[model samples]
Target: MDFSENFLHYVWRFRSFDSAELKTAASENLKIIHQGFLNANAGPDFSNAKIQLDGTIWVGNVEIHIKSSDWLKHHHQIDDAYNSVVLHVVYENDVPIKRKDGTTLPVLELKNRISTELITRYERLFLTLTDFPCINQIREVDQLVVDAVLSRTLVERFEQKTGAVIEMLNNLNGNWDETFYRFLARNFGFKVNAFPFEAFAKAVPQQIYAKHKDNPLLIEALVFGASGFLNDEFTEAYPKQLKAEFQFLQKKYNIKPIDATMWKFMRMRPQNFPTLRLAQFAALIIKANHLFSKIMAITDVSKLRMLFEGLPVNDYWKTHYHFKKQAAAVSIQFGKTSINNVLLNTVALFLFAYGKHTATQSYINSAIKLLETLPAEQNAIIERFTGAGVKIDNAFGSQGVLQLKKQYCDEKKCLSCGVGVKILRSSSNHH
Candidate 1:
């Protein structure tokens, strides 16, 4: 079986291997100490494991399975990999698994041996009956313990971001700023509207960013690129003028204009469509042309806010980006809530990325601080992530959210997550 991390932990906790005794088949007195399930790869599937057997303190790999028979069913034998079987654990022990050399491998079956509370915790968490795991029990883990686990989870969070970063890198031509913008745009949709904004960014290429460097027209190009209005042969004067401009720009840059669907306006106010968001994004960029450099330089949260304060968009855009009713033309203005939400999230991720060198604590603190700076989140992404804005909970909550979101929640990797591992291990250790 191409067993993922889930069954591995289940096996370890249940100890399907000869739980009858704490010794391997080789007369080694086996002792299980630390149990980890995050960093394991080829040999044993746990991160940092401490197991002693035969009075010899040995540490290498510890593999877990649903049944002892899985050792061969998963082809662990004859693979030369089973040779490192310091301990074989399983949830259920039916038949004894023999290595290729014909020696009974050590097995621990945990059905009757482990604690009841640990198992209950696991069930409560992975089964998803509530908002969070250990809601009542979470408080039991003192502040120090919570901090330790959160820190570990944060590291897990970083490891998780590495994949997205890699994928994002593939999208951009190795330009960090381009990748940042694209991600920022996608994040605006908060997954529900992600593809729409991504379509927006692609339709308005980096080449265009150059063309409109000093002018907001490039911003307009990006903002309106995914609105689908450009695809129509409208007799409307502004539409016709934009089309004419697009034709010239298209020829100049060899870029194709994207005709992606607008993010839904159904049930949404007119201000929520592709038009307004694009305008706001345009204004933010125009206002803060040196945004990336500023973000990298600043460690203080207030400093970050100062960088973005200059971008309220010129009067012409504040009310018009989203709607235009002839004589009552509205200029588009990016509300403080939307801009700060994006900036804070960006800063959090940036600090998370660069935490090794600088005071990661400041990054964490800044994330918390910026929530107050932002207007209670009116946007969908922030609302979903932070539970309706102006979050009072500290970065500890943020760390949990980072993992709970990025790993368990977003990708459904709960089975392989540290939280999931915690469930199984905690179950095995239950009272």
Candidate 2:
């Protein structure tokens, strides 16, 4: 049928073949005492399987393939690792296989043992022309199972996403506040200019900002100058003053600006321009100097949201999206949606990462609770899952679904996925 080797592994691992009259190719009576643990690494498909053959018990690894000839195709004949395999299971018994010791290995062919209906169901579900493999039947799965899967996926998502933050923590020599500052700086870019913003923050270290924290004007000058925004001549009074101030500060700090070409603005909304974001970011620095400590102390989500809301952006940014470039006056307030995004991405992630680093469960619990309190995010992936009857009403559910779509569905690792496993098992004879 040209199915993948993973499908055969799934069938063998789950014991989906008929076992009423099991026998080896040598016609010896066989019984399975225990189906070994599935191995994700090299050397074996399953390990330490216990089986009875010809009334004698044997304990060793088990290897499975689509055809018996695959043992030769994989060159297992010469590899000493395959010598411990007590049973050679295959979908079809096309040829006999010899162990590395030159002894004939016991073969268990399952050509007619697996049901045709089960194969067809797997083919239809996994081989479908859709991003979500089981979308059509997702609604039929039990709600409790869906919730359980989502909860697990949510933890997986947190683990996957927080890895970069922890690596940054290590690179900063375990400076939590400085690490948080850089992470917050990256998220301030909001994905469009995240790289340049992070580079800009690295170029102008937080210690430099701490020196001039009381002076909001110098902080703005350093942020803009280090971002390469103060390089051009400005005719406007405010930008001219900022340029003059940055020229002195840039020499004092010995800071070099990142490439101006790093920032992007095409097809972007004016409010999301990097210049406005930089001004708001400088305002945030002026407002909160040591932000990581404040975040750790606050458990209430509302207070956390308050940290990003109503930032004191200056009048120049309130009327302009760029330095010396004036646009129609717009409210330069960071919108509610943007505030929530910051809370979710930066605040919750740092809390979770810090909790894991210090072995503190309260911080982890607070992180999850904050996500549950926030509203669910709307995106292309969330929409598809919601359309498939999956209930995702909070950031917790949305994050889990996002992880599921990216890790499981896109990769087509159905055998390892909770929802895919449930559907496959229900469709088969396995319990």
Best by TM-score: 2
Write out the backbone clash pairs for model 2.
none
The Cα error of candidate 2 at residue 206, in Å, is 0.6
- lDDT string for model 2 (1-431, tens) is 86888888888888877888799999999999988989999987999999999999999999989899999999999898999999988889999888877899999988888888888888988889788999998898897899899899899999887888889888999999999999999999998999999999999889888898899998998988899988888899877888899999888879999988999999999989998899889989988888899999997866898888778888887778887667898778888888888889999998999998899999999999999988999989999999999999899999889988988999988888888888877877652
Worst 10 residues of 1 by lDDT: 387-396
| Number of the predicted model whose lDDT against the real structure is largest | 2
lDDT for residue 398 in candidate 1, whole number 0-100: 56
**In model 1, what lDDT does residue 239 have?**
52
The CA lDDT of each predicted structure is 0.57, 0.89
Residue 180, candidate 1: C-alpha displacement in angstroms: 2.5
Worst 10 residues of 2 by lDDT: 422-431
